[model samples]
Target: MKSTTLSRALLASSIALALAGCNSSNSNDGGGHTLPLEECKTYQSAPEVIVLSDNENIERQTITIGATGDMHGRIFAYDYALDSVDVNAGFTKISTLLSEERAQNPNMIMIDLGDTLQGNSAELFNDLPVHPVVDTMNFMDYDLWVPGNHEFDFERSFLDKNIQAFEQAVISSNIVWDKNSDACATNGEEVPFLPSYQIFEIDGAKVAVVGLTPSWVTNWQASSPQNFRNLDFKNELESVRKAVEDATAKHQPDVVIGALHWGRKDGGTGVHKIATELADYFDVLFMGHEHAQFIERVEKDGDYTADQLNISVRDADGRPQNQVEDKNISERYHSANRHESVKVIEPGSWGWALAKAEIELYKDADGKWQIFDTTLANRTVADIEEDAALQQEMQEIHDASVIDANTQIGTVDGNFTFTGHVSKFGGDEAVHEDPQFDGATNRLYTTIHHAKVADMPLVDFINQTQIRVIEEKATDHNGNPVKVDVSAAALFGDSSNLTDGQVYLKKDSANLYMYDNMLVATEISGEQLQNFMEWSYSYFNTYQEGDITVSFNKDIRAYNYDLFDGQGFTYEVDIAQEPGNRVTITSIRGTEFDKDATYVIAVNDYRFSSTMVPNGWVSEEDELWNSADETVYAIRDMLTEYVAETGTLSAGEFTNQNWHIVQYGQTDAEGNLVGDKGALLKARETEEGSKLWQQLQNKEICVVREESRDSDITIAVNYKDGSTWYENPQPGTYQGCVH
Candidate 1:
């Protein structure tokens, strides 16, 4: 039965490949379009082929598999948003590598792990007859296509179009049609959104490829449920296991591969857990969605070890060896499994590298073809030149995207991002060079390190835009007009900043607000708001007695670190306090805060679904409004709309100066911050004897923490003119310093 279904598919594919070979004459460009052979002939480089296992058996057979994912629509080696030529990454470069590899070994299987249709300049061609990215993949002859979470970021029709346009098998076992819903009703028939898996006969041995998409798409795209429409993203582990078992029981594939559109440690359904739980079922797993690169081998008992071939190419026994870096590598496991280990490989995002797995097969005593050995490598495309033919074909699409991205939307007179020195001292002299800097009113920019450590104009701009959009269009649960008192938003891009007196283009807006999250207004008590702030501020590392520089917790993601701006409110985050005790609301609407008082707050729909509702901080039924209901659905669009309407961009219109972050070395009997790092902060109110603050703000002076002669903590200041000011201040024994 399995042979009857899959054999026909494979036969059709082979026939198509033969026709493509005949049509191209030189290369097998699977797409119907003729190849620009003469243009590409010069740029073609010889492929580097390395034997994974040392074998001389004549009966041994081999199959090379190539994989890519988290591409995010980087079709060409050009950044449309930045309007610059990115020489390092893009699918065009990967195409060159693919052509070279295919030339070396035509038995190769090409698979795209997904996240292929959203970023870079892919959205520009969404309404076209065929998406350029899909067209390029077709031209490259990709065999299996797996859908990633971001693939559903656009409209359902757009996603449907691309899926239909792909010439190969687009498989995902977990995404099934919601038969219970009217939109996807199949008259009580159970139906998967796409085929569960695809089997191919390579070198007379059956190879099965099963696809699994992340189940958490429901939470990420909660704001726009219509993107997925009637599709249900089922549990990853269950769906994938069923698909693998079914394929094995029927086809008995020589090698079972898991084309998982998920990261290695993405909560429960990560490839590490899947490899451990379903070790016997899978031979290799190709991963994506974290945009990271690594090749890890996991034991049947879940013992993990990573073999990074790019860092150091030495082979340990049969596995490559290297130390895992701080950037989320797998843990070392001393325990070993008696059975064969599962191999998992992931290529970094944006077409930086191609994840390759070479499997060697040999006949067993029973005359059945079995996997002899497997080796994985993430082949880099940084040195590989972009395929000339691919470039020529995509030149028009590239030019149009660049022109759209560079269209000037507005102008800014000053920098919206913090760029100066960030001192613990918030004194008057340390205030921003801008004449409008004010501390008590919260309309101020002191030192530069304000973004994650303290509130700044960059974050304020997003919060203000969200609040304005909600206040203008949102209504209460009963359809009455609503007023938004506070708004919270996270800084999505680290390099998101606007230059002074520069023409703000569409790209700049996209950089500032990177996601397509819709706005939502909700009602919560003062206590809940404080708790939310505390949770967000927990991203910071607690200040110790001797710590001079502020740092953040590496375990937390920057997107989860949110800041707030309100119509009338001021608060402080004390780094000296613990995570849960950091936030303190000083005033609300010029009055002292009451924990029991209720307030209306606006935030992105992602936060409303991923955090507030799930944490029981806010009820879903009491939700006030959703921006999706209005014409301006995305926050990114609302930002452009706000800027377009305002005509001019200025800090005065957005920055609320409602929040401050403080770290103190000593406190008085009444818990007041005394002379130390604390005194410099309080001196801002008086604006007198602020010479030291001025020096620190201008980068003429630097602060350093060291140990004193007596082993006490010493606060030292180095002046530009070769002067040293040191102080060893202890509780009630303050040693003042002089330069």
Candidate 2:
């Protein structure tokens, strides 16, 4: 039976519900109907039941599969130096490379693993009714497309509209809709949102391709409940297994391939394990989602008997093998009687490269096609020349986006720069000592200074916008405007020359968006707030007295470093301290912080959804408001409005320096300092030495570096009440953090 007919017959209810969710009145047009399963059917008959036809003739054939994913709307390459030079990997170059490959082999299949849309600033002005990326893909004649998690960032209607506009067959085995609501329900079973797989006839050979998505879509940081309300994600492996079984049963395909949208890194779910366990079922696996490039060949030796197995297995080359002997190896070998091997590859994101898998098949004695050999290659786009015709075709859209990005929003009297010398060891004076140290660490310090240390106009401006907007829309249960205690912002994207006294909504059309544009508000106890600050503090790596450079933890997302405004708090960071214990909130608005007190906080969506709660730095249950649902405008739009209305920007208006960082130390009850005060003093006297004494005198924090022959470094922090805490540096060769 045809896949569409069977799907319609089985999932009539699901189709109806999906159409309803799309808010379409006409179901006859098939606007939001699920894809039929038979389209990807593999075998001509069930593998267990099929009888081999002795007379069938099998011939040698070769096929090439080219794949790319997570392009993220990077249609044009970037020239970082000139900013608009268009000199690197992009769709135009990718198209040229794919075309060249196709010329070499007419039997090539082009597959996009997923995350093709979104990410570019141009997407903001993409009101042309036609998605440029989809148009480009159609021009390239893409064979199949899968939706990545980011595809669901927009509302369901938007997603449905885009899917309707695409010409390629979309496939995902796991996404399903409610089956009870449509007339086509077969036993009330849920049906796939898209075809589970597809079959291609390459030189008289049938090759089956199955699709899989990340099973944890609902929990995605960017996915809101409203965007994917009616959709359900099933176990990725189970979905693929079912699809493989169905395909093998009906088509008896000679080759089975998997085009999966799941990634193998950053704690991605199932795809890695699925590739390992199901190696025998698939000939090739195309994977994405981590935005990384990788290729690996996974092999499983057939189970061995006790006599055939040893403590370790070695190949003829005397090299150690990666084989493990299972206790039930004999059972598996007797039951399945086969070994498994599969090749997996992923192209890096943003069209940097394309993953190519070559499959060579030859006829076996039994007249069945058998894999002769397989090879994987990653073709990089760094040196590939852009396709001139395609570039010309997209040039107009690119120009328009550039113009939109250059639209002037406002002007400032002074430059907003991220450069300065700031470190935990010394205060702002560190910049005076080492100019190269300025960038992120200094900007971070400034952010904290403006947010909590003093009346920071920039952060305050952002806070006021969020607070005013939220107040206008939402109220407390008693109908009063909800009061917010803290507001946060991040220095997203590269710093621009706003110092020229003019500001555009974006730096240029090429660099158009700041990431901290989505706002979310939540309520948390003071303890949670402190914990959140501690999480921010985790960005800094601990350093000792002789450590010349104070660096940041590379593993932490740079954008997650947030500066909080609306609260007055001072913190002391001992680089030598552990993560959770590094930050000590000295006071709030000149008073001791009440740990049990509840405070409302306003933060960007990226910060709230992904960094804070998802990372376990904050609790999701404490969320009080999400700007995505509560407001009509994003934080960027709000900033635009605020700037346009105010007409002028001044650093003094936003500059608040209320908080200061102190190098942590310890002292005794009698207020006498301990440890290597001489080392600390000698280090401070050097040109590169952290001027700890000056910083302490300026900030009035009772911290002193003391000398001791027995200790490498000793720190003493005195309280205003005459009590002191003393500490000695832990012993270790300090290796800086990793990215």
Candidate 3:
């Protein structure tokens, strides 16, 4: 379907897209509106013609197909009883979405690509006779099942035993089993691989699904941290060969589907190339791996045009060659046609997204189901509806995924999730959303809360929202007019790796960085903390003691690699080279009253906090956001409520533009941005020592300085005169240099 059609469809739907809250055009309640693409009244989408202008009448034979990858075992723990009503209710929403779109067109087939196990709540109950996950999935009625690397994680035995888990045709053109054993031989089983193909007759259209799995499973066993077994994963091409030949030889499907268990982004190679080559064997390709890649990156033919990358890859065959990096899964399937590769969809890991394909099955076309038109997208969970039964199952799965031994040493009054606190949504939160709602406008009001625990019936005054500090009119708890910064810091666990709508329990030791500095205070101490914070100079480099005027999320690095460069958070009295590998607990300016006192900090939670870092890093305070509330979920409650009210979420889009962040390749130490027109991203390295180091800078007569004499610190200064002093520097930088 065209973007216009989707956008229009969005306008008609009463359910909200979490990330797209501000973009929703219809204010009134209209959850059921249906308008055709020709008469769409929503925001205009990019011209549909541009999407397929490269092809002629073939463009008419298009189907926008959306498929999701790496679902794992998410569907199973969805309902406790694992009943069809519950499973179908959960899937019904997706089905409803599919049905609505079908009204727009006719042949949209929603495909669940692969990886329907692992991290799934139901995986905990795999030993049960009734596999909740597989059964629910079967009820969902997916078009086909593509084998994932993890499917063989429990050893091939489980796969062999549960081959029937998938209600759809199980296609693993890449996996194999020992002959006549009725079980996937584990630990080097030499059986021939399974037939890699599945033929689908959707709306009377012939679509063949040829599946392939990454050979990387050979190196990584199932849940390596948990001692899951590793099996021999054969070449992706080997299985494709078997499946393709078999499928076409027996029956010529109008459309060939390549459901390879390979990834799209950062999979060492452009999986699209594999898709393209498979395209030579198959008509279309749906790929996985790399945690859901951008739809635009996977080309039907192969590698991007030279103009796009300024380079081209070719093989001995002299055409475009595929480059597989990291010595891993590469172009296993180079197309025989060399022109049509695959239509890949590297969907989000852990069931975060699902892709759907809408095609027209037309006649006068040999009366076969030839694809008439098509497109793909990583559908955001924000636009999704949670099946009530699925929700229950999800909870059970969560309970199962986590080991619930009598290890409950501490009981938090409420539960938590990273989505709420890591990504705040009030004043500053509202301002953050303005770019879409109006990026040019800044009407954000921040409310900061600080409880006076020392004083009973304690002062519950708002800090930024009316705390002991600045006051501003910001979004309230109801998402309406209220008070100051409502920043919440998740008390336990890192919020980075959390899947959509996951409810996490709060432990006493969890924390996040506030303004990117809390992690330093909590996670590191001495030199280690200093080193981490120094890298973060791009964000927390400067701060006046009492200023509360910046967005905390502005300079964060997601996935925990938001490398740090210590800046204003603290001045390191680095004495590493002198006597002791010591650094000082200078300050943590990313919070309310932070940096005022020396603290023992928790790395992640403190930095992500909007309320306060943590008692470990600051003066002790109640770390839990909704501690008094009678909810199992502390941080998780807010998000669940938000979703229940809004029914959608929005993960940021994938883009190559590094506007908020400097391209990693260009940034350098001492804060010099190589190609950014002298943008000193970090403090310039200088000879002038901080006031604390002046004496050392002035006394630099290369005295008989022994490494032991230094006071776990060195004073340094570059004097006005030629003389220079040195307490302890990083060595080799005598006169003066940046640390």
lDDT on C-alpha atoms for all candidate structures:
0.65, 0.55, 0.34
Q: Which candidate is the best by lDDT?
A: 1
* Distance from true location, Cα of 320 in model 3, Å: 36
lDDT of 3 by residue, 225-323 (tens): 111122234566556666787777777766666776674432343354455445556545666765533333234555532211111122233211111
Runs in model 2 deviating more than 4 A are 1-58, 78-83, 125-128, 178-188, 221-223, 266-270, 298-341, 418-473, 494-502, 508-513, 551-555, 569-572, 610-622, 629-632, 658-739
lDDT at 212, model 3:
75
| CA shift of 27, model 2, Å | 22
Residue 42 in candidate 2 has what lDDT? 22
- lDDT score, residue 336, model 1? 29
Ranking by TM-score: 1, 2, 3
Cα-based RMSD of candidate 1: 12.7
lDDT by residue for model 2 (1-739), tens = 0011112232333333322211111112223343322311221211222121222344776678888888877677742212353433478878888888889886688889887876664344233334567767777777788888777655555456566556657778888764543433446567677778887766566778898877666665442565564667788878988988888788878778899987553343345566666777787788888665556555543221111122111223422221212223212211122236566677777786777877777776766677766666677675678877777766654554454445565777643332222322211222211111221111211111212211234444566667666766756545667667767665443322234255544432122124324566677778888888788867665645553223455456545656665646544455567677866666665578788888788877667766667666567776666666533446756666556667776655554443333441332221123333333334555653344334333432222212111111122321221222212132111111100
Best by TM-score: 1
By lDDT, rank the candidates, best first: 1, 2, 3
lDDT of model 3, residue 623: 25
Put down candidate 1 lDDT per residue, 84-167, tens digits, no spaces: 666656888898888878888786889999999877746545545456688778777787799898887765666666676777
Candidate 3 TM-score, true structure as reference: 0.43
